[model samples]
Target: MNEDERVELVRLLPPPARPELSADRHRLLRGHLMSELREQPVRVRRGRPGRVVVPALAGGLALALVLTGGGSASGPDRSQAPQATQAPQAQPSAGSAPLNAAPVAAVRLLNQAADAADRAQDTTPRGDQFVYVKSVQTYPSTDEATGEATKGTPQNREIWRSVDGSRWGLLVMDGQRRPTGQDLKDPHARPDEPAPHPLGGGWLEPTPGNTGPSGYAYAAALPTDPDQLLAKLKADTKGQGPGPDQEAFATIGDILREQLVPSPVRAALYRAAARIPGVTVVDEVTDAVGRQGVAVARLDSGGVVETQWIFDRSSFEFLGERTVAVKDDGSWRKGEVTGQTTILGRAVVDQVGDRP
Candidate 1:
């Protein structure tokens, strides 16, 4: 390759990459007799763009930290002032998908999530890693959270942790109207000083008490398989409801026990299912990533006319879960009652320990 060949080849290069080429590129191309050339170093170096590799696991956590972008107050432009939140309005991009895309991975991921949650339930907190929930709350209406939590509908939630062979640490959230009276009794407990911990240990400081409703609802989650999780949730919730008038599920009387997690998302479905007296899964769709899953149910709660989608198989990764709610006026209002949160995240190293 002579100067002539190099020059011609250089002229054909694209701008961003071409700028990196050497003047010698064109000179050598100018003399090229054939399209084919000998393999050699390119004196003019147009370095390839550096690829940014996403770290699969970070901060001693195994689950990849995939940030869900976007989360601004939706609905018609409201006049009320906005409250601060930890996440950005989940931005909807072309890359995003509806709840039903890639059914297989969705199901698997969901199951894995449930499994993780179950494990978090069992994980003993050790080292820096910690299992915890930030907060949870309930709102009578979307606007019910008018910067005043106490005036809003009732909400309740609790948190427990086990670190470094220690006992379960509990943190019961409080409300202005009816404080659970549960306190952080473990004075020996310490916040994570370093990076995230393994086997259930990573407590990002509580999201401040009385921020804006949204107490710990289902927001405080631990890794668990979707199947087991749903089963556990269903089992624990069986015959459970505040009472009769208050309980969002099958009730004993008018007393609501758990703050109508009402599916929290599939709220309508769960709430309706709760009424069915006996709601259970009938079908499911597997999701990608191989570790998650989702399911559909024939809820006997009401007339069995509704479709409830369960997003967890055993582990709670992320899949599809939705529900419909029925108001007191014999009217039907729909909403996503079931959902999840970053309750606990673990990595291979965190659980297995580092090797030398």
Candidate 2:
């Protein structure tokens, strides 16, 4: 079939009653889509015959669902995961300006954060336990037609992750419970085997791996020494994002926000972050929840956006993180808050819906 005919055929398939795709099939389709679009830039806008336009925030949620292997449970047989009380959203600020290239201050602050992490009272979770995290986040959305940027509303998000990478996890957002991963009754099922979804549909059992960024198993297995951890981060995330240092910093932030890590590993992550070039100290910044704090930040390759990890000024505890536009990049204005998050709580829970 010609390329256009193939694309049309794929698009003509009826949408599945339940939104479930096996990991292998999902990867195959994604690769095919990329190959088809390799020579043509796809503009995501309205009224295009062959284009699909997704709202930015909804797209973010969809990505989260895919990564966690969770979406809306469709069948009556599916159980609802327990919902946590939703916290109030705080008004987002414009964020602070980068004062100077204070590497000394940044390194000192990271070391302090690392020290605090080492002294933290953290309990090791068993294989069957789940790691629960609560947070509020906001990301920027752009009008595809006008290319105008606007900040998204702060959203409360909760997630439950499998402790040992063997069980299904859960994500709660907008009052909906989405379970992740296939419920594999046969422990010996291979990645190529078809596993029935708890709701309805066949999903390929995901291969066991330490590559999932949010998996506690992966986090716990990280090198505890700062230098080795940094090197590992670079190696694993090579060729991702705009640059290596930025990608490593962002990966560490992702792990910190979601997974429950051992104290030593957590310390190592922070110390490793300190060694990344272009990282600086921002004296003051506010998280999505409006708590003011200091930050360790790095600018993107274009030097237009600065991603900051906010911390409690007095306690050196991590509050959350934010991304501010450092330069006007046509669509975004300088000092605009592009994205932000405030971590409310994290713990090792007994079940998918249980609170700590």
Candidate 3:
């Protein structure tokens, strides 16, 4: 199938719920299968009256569903998942009563971000192009026994991804060049030692994996209707992680940060997030990069850490993500900063390693 048709068809198919597997193993399987699909000859044919269609690859899709833990073709049975809690809306701010209800300030902010996304003039990238993102990442240290905060370094990060998922990508950290490999191999590689952390940072080529129904094509294919989008995300993450709410929130964050989802989809994603239970606003917060913004956060069950997504207060642009210690664990204190990522820039580029 051609790119446009392929994207549309894939979008229509609901993403599979995440399966139980090591993250690395999952990526490997997805990458391999997706590559295989790409190899099949593209066939153009007549459609009924005024439409063109591509036949679904049942086997490939089924395999993807199974491997990704997306459940069956009928979609994930969310009956077993925990239901979302109803959150109180916030009071409206300033003079904008019509759209600034406090109970839903978080939602309103997201809506604004969505509107900004809709109005954004973005380039339609080519298959061989790349999506370049620059960010600053920080990892805070803590004393395991007392949960006390310790010293940490913030690393400058640059990432480039092949727009078509060819697996050609590059990562640069703090001006240091990581070793380039085809997949998630060790960044500190040698001719002899090879395996690296699956989620570790390094130069990468196409590996045998996919991040469920993530990446550009998957994001573009997402439903734009808020309710439908929320349902899709809930279904995609059902029974997958700590809980549906937390996992769903995380999935949305990944889509925002990791993929080049269309503006409409991005807006839908933000709106869908507003529907999840327990997501409340943190009026002001700082990201790892130290820029301040309003935050929407979700606390995990144990209350050890709260994931906060920070955004510009006025513009509603996404600023970064942060993890705050809500309660003292052995390694962290309450209110301690655990990790942060400040997004600096994102843009479409002509080639891998090209700066936006």
Tens digits of per-residue lDDT for model 1, 211-249:
211222232231133233334444545566433222332
Off by over 4 Å in 3: 1-103, 140-151, 179-201, 207-214
User: Please, what are the lDDT tens digits per residue for candidate 3 over residues 1-356?
Assistant: 89888767766765544446667767776666644543443232344321122344443364555465653345556563443455996765885323212224455456667777777776777777777888888887677998777757899888877777765576778767455543436565444333443434565555323345546766777899988988888888788988888888998888787556778888888878887887766665777656777778888877789888888866678888888888768667888878887889988888656665
Which candidate leads in TM-score?
Answer: 2
Worst 10 residues of 1 by lDDT: 33-42
Candidates ranked by TM-score: 2, 3, 1
lDDT of 3 at 317: 84
Query: Tens digits of per-residue lDDT for model 2 on 171-198?
Result: 6654543332334345564444433323
Give the TM-scores of the predictions, in the order they appear.
Answer: 0.25, 0.63, 0.62
Comparing 1 with 3 on TM-score, the higher-scoring candidate is 3
Better of 1 and 2 by lDDT: 2
Runs off by more than 4 Å, candidate 2 = 1-101, 142-149, 177-207
Q: Please identify model 1 stretches exceeding 4 Å from their true place.
A: 1-130, 134-158, 163-168, 172-300, 304-316, 319-322, 326-356
Candidates in order have lDDT scores of 0.30, 0.71, 0.68
